[model samples]
Target: MQRNASKPWLGALSALAMLSATAAAAQDKITIGLLEDVSGDIALMGAPKLNGTLLAVEEINNSGGIMGRQIEIKHLDPQMDNARYQEFARRLIKRDKVDVLIGGITSASREAIRPIVNRSDVFYFYTNQYEGGVCDASMVSTGAVPEQQFSTLIPWMVEKFGKKVYIIAADYNFGQLSAVWTRDILGKLGGEVIGEEFIPLGVSQFGQTIQNIQKAKPDWIMTLNVGAAQDSFFEQAAAAKLDIPMGSSIKIMLGFEHKRFAPPALANMHAVANWFEEVDTPAATDFKKRWRAKFPDEKYINDMGYNAYVTVYMYKMLVEAAQSTAKEDLRKVIATGEACIEAPEGRICIDPKSQHTSHHMRLISVDDKHNVSVTKDFGLIEPYWLGEVGCDLTQHDPKEQYDPNNLPKK
Candidate 1:
């Protein structure tokens, strides 16, 4: 009887030890939250962004992940609704407790969760080309800023295409700020702005705006619209036969959005972009080869999707460099402006002051074959809005400048 009792005790002890080992192994996994618009207006961009994030995570995990722990991402679709964005952000912070967050294809979605991120003290990496003037200690802007996109593109347009300009943009923070900077820069370059118009978001019919552009007959038309609205505007302009040359801060040719709507009529429209996968560079060629192998059907990867992939790898580098997932330490490392990602556009880095990324911007034009092609390379542009606009970011804390409902009024 004593021998049998002793045997049972030993077996129970061994079971407990095995369970503890399994628990330790599970705890080693690192979690990241990928919040994006996968089901709404910007779904075209969002779907690819999600896929790119997944591809990056897969590559990292396959290589043994960060410090022997696999990286796990929780994908959440906010559906492009502002309220849904806030809710999912709360889930990421409270429920999932993700080590970091990545997403935001649209400026409106990014702005919606900006305050929530600040309040929770989470590191949110936003990947999209947008208007500048955003500096936050907790947030890292990894996309092309106004300096990277507009500053170079606008000046090049003025010189190359003659500078009597007309501006038509979506009526929002991104659009408003883009128009403001365009007007400011054009004036500095001895150019005249003949007309400026703002349209409400999601307004499909652009008949009135097309008429206005035709009547004004500006030397160049600069646009800042996005999503379906941009498609609609271009379609209407083509139908009306308004032939003024158009330039955009957003790269319309980088994705299928323009292909499905604008078609041959969109041929010759110019855009400023950070990267084009087709351009033959060592970095771009390597990326294209790997990407094509992975996705045989996909002909081209859009800029936003490419940025999403880059952001994931950038976060991995930061996590490994810091050797800790503590939000404060990670934030400091990102804000230092020295970190860079191996992107198709070559090495891209963030400017410490503005917290905006600096990368090579390419001027792309739609060709007669209905395919987008790179026309010119502007090379690398540094982030310097304070010098350009005379507004200092160093004087004030980013936290102090952040107001949830009240964005900078134009």
Candidate 2:
């Protein structure tokens, strides 16, 4: 009986030792929670974003990792479900305890998980071009906003196309808010939105919408369609021989619609954004070469993917600058406006006041051959709307995204 009791005690000791070792190993890694759509309505764009994130972690780890600790990524596909975003965000913060949370392809998804991150004090990085007006210290937005996108495109559209415009966008916060910005810019430019329609993300058909555009006979159509629902509009427009010029904020760059759809469909499309795959720079070229080397079988990398890639590196830079992974220290470092990185797009820096990034923007026009050309470069445009509307995260973080409708007039 004594011998058997001693054997059980020995087994318990072995189990305790294993548990201790596991805990020690866990301390040797920094984890990032990547919440993206891998297989759903948004996967066409989200997959590239996921690849960018995974690639960054691999590179960081291969180069001896962050602070000599390896990067561990907990990538959960939300399948384009907002509810899943909330659920996974909770899981990441409470259960897995990720060091940082990165990924939210759309403004809807970002807003869905924003509150959860704010409450938990988990550092979040929203790596996609959005409708702007987010003011939060708990998170940093590292993508183009309406100001960066429209400042050049709208003026050029009005100059080349005409003063009359038709608006078509995905029916979400992103689309709705972006439309507001469009009207604001166009109104100032002595242009007008003659007709408009908000299409659901699942609805790819555009027969009636195209007819409305034809009836309106606007100078240009502002096409902000996203995801799988995008291709059909271009195809249907071509079949109808609409032949009108199109001006947009979120067009070919993210979805690569210019590449996906056949010629002339996107020939008249002009997109203004922060990053496009065709953007040529020494930094961008090297980045593409490395991305190709890793993802040889990968399709086109869009703006969202490039933003994710830059943000991951930015996070590493901030963490190292703070010399700690604590959220408090990171916030202090970011508030200094030193949380900047030389990205594929160029030197992108966070505005110490608004917690929004200033982007290197471009106006890219697609040709009949589906080739993209940089028509103009709007170098390092600051996010004007949020700061213009009293968002100063350094002193006071409202921890909320303000609606354009409710904002104070400039």
Candidate 3:
């Protein structure tokens, strides 16, 4: 059979039409640049975070999406590398043209990409518990910060555990700064840090560190260990049978270390958290059930995962309230209104002035069988660190993370 030249020309025209249609369809959807560390030292938390974001995006798309526009997420794994975070942030902004940005497990990673988003005028959501005091018009931190966690945790530890404690934190901006907050809060609570240690990520063995803690023999241990390798500290402590009561700001909540490690590993482990899989609220139970139905293999829904899930819905609320996804409009809604959401963990409200979420915190512990239960409830703590220190995003966009070292004195 002989093909006609006219037919060949018709096929080329059809292909061109299809390309144009695809581009138009993409333009109709709102884009989200999702950066997560699905691999490397922080994968334990990052992989779960990506899963939660995907789940929320799917639900949002199914429910008519944000402002009638479907969400199209452009995901990139930074692998816990700061350089990769910067490169990926730039690519997502310049190439993908995403309407919003979300991710960053560590404070270092947040600082790495925050400037890029600020310069590009992109809205950003950081959904992990961190050292507080980030003030920026282009961002909202929905995670529990030191003000929410340490304020309640330190006092509880001092009241129950003892007045003397040992702190083992990771050697990074988050861990180091969290350590500082712990010291400050504990000191205020009339407690003292008898021994302090900072461990680098990917250090599994804790022989020397365990010896140090044993020698110090404080009332209890405050474990700020982060990442997968550092999780081994729980196992080592168990093996050595360091039966001393321990408290933390992260231990069981962010990493779900109790569920991952063997029984008795986290026997005496206690931590302050905004939410956990076992929170038992009707919303929390439904969320856990649905997540398990979708991801049958997932072990536990940690705090980071819940934060990612809630932050996505928070973005939806902001878009619908503002009637637009433009950065300026969203900023206006956040700046003008006390934005609140009924998440799995009760009510979470945005502190408009500080650009952080007020969290419902609790002190929880795990038994030898790895069962977690709330020991005490500290209801709805507003993120007060930035506001108390004079960093108000509504008044000015400083574009800086205020820590103990660089805080402005009122």
Candidate 4:
């Protein structure tokens, strides 16, 4: 009886050891949570972002995944609501137990989840061009900041258009910071900001703003409206016959939604972007072909989508480099700035201090076909353009450093 009991105990121990080894070997299957907007005003940006992220994951998995285990993505829709975003963040961290988190189409949404992310202990990657000056330890902002978006565009517009400018933006953080940056950069470039107006987000009527624009008669109309507000503003601008050469920051001609909603008068409008499908770059072409083949019905592909897709691949690269799903280890690897994505533009690298990715920003125009085409490519812009100006514009305190509301006034 004693000999039989000893054999059974040894067998149980052997089984447990095998299980432990399997678990150790399977550490490459890094789980990520995608908190994005699929159904809301910003769905145009969010839905495609999710699709892009999935495509990246699919490609990575097909290419043998990370360290032999498949990468898994758990997606959640926040519906563009702050409260919902907070809840989703909690679910992603607590229930889903994701190793990393990515997705935020708007600055408001990013702001909403910032605190939750800081407390969650999971690495968060924000992949949208936004208002600048965010330095957070827990978050990596891979999107173009104010310096990346406004710094180049402002000077370019001043040189191409005229010195006098009118600024119109949604009354939010993004809008405010964009307006401030426009004022500052244009002023430095010898341009004058003649008029600046802030409209509430989703406001349908722009007749009054147009009237103000006409009265000011600035040489160029600089805009920062997005989502429903952009639709309303452009529609009303066309209806009101406000025909000034307009240059905008966010959602000027982002995707099919903007192309469909914006009137013909808004054609040839210029905006700075990280990527456009028409650029004909090797990376862009390959991504477009694969994406089109995969989702034949999909009409438009924008930077928002491309960024999300790249994030997944970036996650894969970091995971593979670390060879484990340990969140802290992956975070350190990504934060090192050594990891890069072969994006459409070229080699995209993260700014080690700010944890923001650097990529090419193009000065693109919407043609008569409602298709966006690039006119001039501003080579890669780093994360902190204002770093020289005494601003610790790194990724240490993203929330404290970036406040769209407290933007500079003309």
Q: Which consecutive 10 residues in model 2 have the weakest lDDT in total?
A: 401-410
Candidate 1 lDDT, tens digit per residue, 130-234? Answer: 776665666777778766777777888888888899998888878887888788788889998899998888888888888888888898899777666556777
Candidate 2 on 67-105: residue-level lDDT in tens?
A: 898999999999888999999999999999888999888
Off by over 4 Å in 3: 1-23
The residue ranges of model 4 lying beyond 4 angstroms of the native Cα positions read: 1-28, 256-258, 334-336, 368-371, 386-399, 403-410
RMSD of 4: 4.9
Residue 248 accuracy (lDDT) in model 4: 72
Q: Is candidate 3 or candidate 4 better by lDDT?
A: 3
For each candidate in turn, the TM-score is 0.87, 0.95, 0.93, 0.87
Each prediction's whole-model lDDT (CA)? 0.76, 0.86, 0.87, 0.76
Per-residue CA lDDT of model 4 for 67-143, tens digit only, reads 77787888988888888888988998887778888987778888888889888778888988788776666777777
Clashes of each: 0, 0, 0, 10
- lDDT score, candidate 3, position 314: 95
Clashes of 2: 0
Model 2 regions lying over 4 Å from their true place: 1-20, 408-410
